[model samples]
Structures are given as C-alpha cells and as structure tokens.
Target: MKLLILDLDETLIHATDCYLDRDPDFEVGPYAVYKRPGLDLFLSKVRSQFHLAVWTSSTRLYAAPVVENIFPHDVDLKFVWSRERCTMRFDPEHHDYEWAKNLDKLKRRGYKLEHVLMLDDTPAKLARHYGNLVRVKPFLGNLADRELFQLSDYLPTLAETPNVRRIEKRFWRKASTSEP
Candidate 1:
C-alpha cells in the first residue's frame, strides 16, 4: 500500500507568524490564512489512491484541534500519529529532545523508507534521512502552487521507480523476520 505521511503547522496550515495563539472558536491563527483552492479536492483524490496519515511533530493535544478544524468529517482519522509517538533526539544546546521520533514509528510499521512519502516543511529534519521525502518551504500564505502537490502529479513516476521498490522489498523482508 502507498503511504503518505503529512506534517502539520507550516506544511498543511500556515500560521501568520511562527507562534499560534490559542482560540477555541478560531480554526486558524489570528492572521493565519487557509489556502483552500484545490487542497480539499487534492486530498480527496489522493485518499482514493493511497493510505493517508498525519504525522506531525505537534503534540496530540495541540495538533488534534487544528486537524479537526481543517479537514472535513468524512475524511478518515485513522492514522493520526503525533509528537508523543515520535522518537526524541537530544539537542545539546537547547537541552531538549528535538522532534525526530515520528520516523521511528513508520520504521516500526515496516514501511520501506522509500515506499513512504513524507511531505514536511522542515528541511533540517528530512534532508539527511529518508529518500522518499518531498520537502516544501513553510507555507507563507499559499497552497495553490503546483509544486506543492508535486507528489500527486508525479505518482506514476514514484510508483515506477525501481530503487523505491527495492527498498520496500527489503523492509518487508526484515519485518517478516522480526515478527514474533
């Protein structure tokens, strides 16, 4: 199955600035904007073809409200994994665990690093790790760009890629052996 993991925050939704003020009635930030031109349709199309999941660094408490507000009720909420499930990495300077643990859950699921497509705005987290990541700049104010949905446009190319298939096979084999 094709798995598509999406990040929140600057990826799917754009906060006006870096910080988001909490408001129960507001779906987005005070100055935040929703780029809705084709996003809902795009998501619907992809959902028909692949298994979808939300793998954000935001805590479940914080992320749940945003996703609930952004997506329609008909959309399945099965694969919503969050920061608590992520593997934390120590940041010596900050004395905190940087949010990098999400990948570990995917790895544990036996997904080949390549069979998975991660759409994240954080280049620093994705750049050196997986081969299947499609990094996007943090959403400034636009989601209508053709480039933002490049993965959907290039699904055929992604499916036909040999290296990705090989990785998937290897991961599956490893999973089979490790199964109890």
Candidate 2:
C-alpha cells in the first residue's frame, strides 16, 4: 500500500486552546477539538487503501487526545507522529510556528519517495516536499464538510496509479479538466 501521511488541527479536526464552548467532542487539557464530519468513514476507506499514518504539527501532549478521539480504537492507523518527529525551521516572516513537518524524515524510514503522499492544509508545512503534497482544504468544525469523501472518491484511482510522481497536483485537489 502507498503511504498516506495525515495532518491534524484543521485537517482531521478543528482544535483551539483559545476558545471554549459548553460541550466539545474532545477535550485535551486546555484545548477543545471537534471532529470533522465524515472523518470516520473517510479513514475507513483510506485505511484499506494506504499505509495510514498521522504526522501532525501539534505536539504529542496536545495531539494525543485529539487523535484518540477522532481515530478511536477501531481505526487501523499504522502510526501517529508529532512535532518531535518533525523538523523545525525559522521563518522570519511567520513567527507563529517553529517547525514544519519534514517529509524527508519519513522518506528515510523506507517509505518510497515516489510512493508517498502527504495530506496537509498549510503549504508551508509541505514546502520542501511540494510535489508529493496534496493540499486538502483545512477543516474547522464543519460537521457538514465533505472534503474527506471528495478525497476518498479520488483515492482509488490514485492508489491504482503506477507512478505517484507522474500524478499532477491538480488531481490532488479542486482543479478539474475535460479532455478526451
């Protein structure tokens, strides 16, 4: 199976330590995270198709509960990674984050360079690995969101593709083409 590395916080779930509501789907210390709609079904379909792993930018302490709540016990996820496993670079322009997910780290772990795909919302996170990154629109507490299924619809064909490197980024997101 091809490798599919996922990102949290606005990708799989919406989380914020800055806000609090009466009730939340998940409570991770001071952070409140909500499940993205269709996440379960999306994971179900993808689990069968890819060697699934979560590589969120969030720290282990914060991302742990969120992962458990969203993925639960039945999800056959292969691995869960956090900021510790990622590489950090200082961006003078953006002071918010100290690091970005380094896809090369996984490449070194024997995941084929041409056979891996990273589903992330922020472009900067995948800046060094642009070609292999599929830009999924960030999800933020949208229970009606269908982004997961939209991706699921495209994955079967993606899994069947013999050369992942040849697959253009257009097929990765919202662009469409009409050609015979």
Candidate 3:
C-alpha cells in the first residue's frame, strides 16, 4: 500500500517567532501554529490516493492540537504517532535520532520501504535510513515550496509508470529475504 508519512513541526506547521506560554505545571513539546498556501488543496489531493499517517518527533500531547487544526475531522486519528515511537539520543552534540522510528512502524505494518514516502525538511534523519523519501527544505512561504512542487510534478509520472509497482515489489522481496 502507498503510505504518506509527514513530519509535523516545519513540514506542516510553521512556527511563529513568539514563544508560547508554557504551562510550567505541564511540561511537553513546544506549541506552534501552521502556515501554508493551498494546504487544503494539497491535503485533499493526498487523502485521495494515499493512506495518510503522521510521523512527527513531537509528543502526542503537543502534536494533537496542531494536527486537529490542520486535518479534517473525518481523517483517521489512528495514523497519528508521536515521539514515543522515535529514537532518542543523550549526546548533546548529536542530533536527535528520532525520525526513522516511523519507518520501523511502517515496516511492521507490512509497508514496503519504496511504497512509503516521507516528507521531511531534515535530510539528516532520512539520509541514512530510507531511499524513497522526498526531502524538502522547510519553508514558511505562502505557497507550496519547490520540493512540494517537484512532488506534484512527479505524481502524474508516477501514476503512469509501471516501474513504481516493480520497485515496490522489489522492496518487499528484499524485506522478506532479510527476515528470519
């Protein structure tokens, strides 16, 4: 199955410069609002063809509000996941090793690596893990950025190409062989 995995912070929601009033009593991930142009159209198109899921580093308590604001009520909430599934690191200098946790989740769910498409701004997270991810730079602009535009450009091509199916099969084949 085709799965679309998205990052929440910079990918879906653009953070404002102001600091959110943190509830000292309640410590959680930072609160941020989203900004994007034609986001509704983009989301609608995505919902049409793909099984949508969120693979964000944000904690569930923090990510839930933002997701509800962005997605329609009818969208399945079961697909939303949080940092609990992410990889964590203690080294201060090392970047958070959290993004690829969703990849594991997807694999456990029987999704082939190629059939899974991750849209993330940070290449560092995906560079070492999955090859099928479409890396996009973070943008706070009013319109869809170049990476998203490129994805749009490729959708039609992907739809018409039989090679994509072959690629998915190959990925599954490799996965089965690797399994004990």
Determine which window of 10 residues in candidate 2 has minimal summed lDDT. 171-180
lDDT per residue as tens, model 3, 1-180? 366787876676566544344312122245345445455666777776666788787678877777777888887644888887776543333644444453655678777765666777765555445465555557664343533434444443343333343444212322232222
Off by over 4 Å in 2: 18-22, 92-98, 171-180
Q: Model 1, range 55-114, lDDT digits (tens) per residue? A: 887778767777787677787754887887766676565666677734545677787666
lDDT of 2 by residue, 1-180 (tens): 888888888888887776545456778887777777778888888888988888887789887777778775876776899988877777556766656877777767877768888888887887567777788788867666877777777766678667676788755545322111
Candidate 3: where are CA atoms >4 Å away?
17-32, 89-102, 141-150, 159-180
* TM-score of candidate 3 versus the correct structure, residues matched by position: 0.69
Shift in Å, residue 97, candidate 2: 5.2
Order of candidates by lDDT, top first?
A: 2, 1, 3
Q: Which stretches of candidate 1 lie over 4 Å from their true place?
A: 17-33, 90-97, 160-180
| Candidate with the greatest TM-score versus the true structure | 2
The alpha-carbon RMSD values of the candidates against the true structure, listed in the order shown, are 9.5, 3.3, 9.5
Q: Residue 95 error for model 2, in Å?
A: 7.0
C-alpha lDDT of all candidate models, in order: 0.60, 0.76, 0.58
Question: Under the 3 Å rule for N, CA and C atoms, how many clashes does model 3 have?
Answer: 0
